[model samples]
Target: MKNLKMKAARAGKDLSQQQLADLCGVSRQTISAIEKGDYNPTVSLCIRICKVLGKSLDELFWPEE
Candidate 1:
């Protein structure tokens, strides 16, 4: 499923995909893939993304029931 929560949090922080990717030490395509559900990121990558967006892993990556 798409990680819309992460995308929203990134937008809320006023960051573009490239900015978020730089903060997380990944490429813009990686971030885009994550958002679009075309990729499943590693746990460490998820943590890095959550930290950059000021969100918890549960908040950004958990599957909603």
Candidate 2:
């Protein structure tokens, strides 16, 4: 699966991993893992990220094909 691209958006918004994690109710490590493609976030986490980034879930998380 293609990994989701989140770090750019976070950086564009000037949000640190900890800040994003706090907003999403997840740990900093979770944010790191997701950004690094070491972990795949659950649907709930994806929803929260999309909300925070002001993007649709389809824009943020989707299979390559």
lDDT of each: 0.93, 0.83
Error of 1 at 15 (Å): 0.1
RMSD list, candidates in order: 0.5, 1.8
RMSD of 2: 1.8
The lDDT leader among the candidates is 1
Off by over 4 Å in 1: none
Clashes of 1: 0
Tens-digit per-residue lDDT, 1-65, candidate 2: 33446876788788999999999999999998898888988898899998997877776776556
Model 2 off-target regions past 4 Å?
1-4
* TM accuracy, model 1: 0.97
Instruction: Name every residue pair that clashes in candidate 1.
Output: none
User: Which digits, one per residue and each the tens of the lDDT, describe model 1 over residues 1-65?
Assistant: 88899889989999999999999999999999999999999999999998888889999998998
Measured with C-alpha atoms, the lDDT of residue 51 in candidate 1 is 84
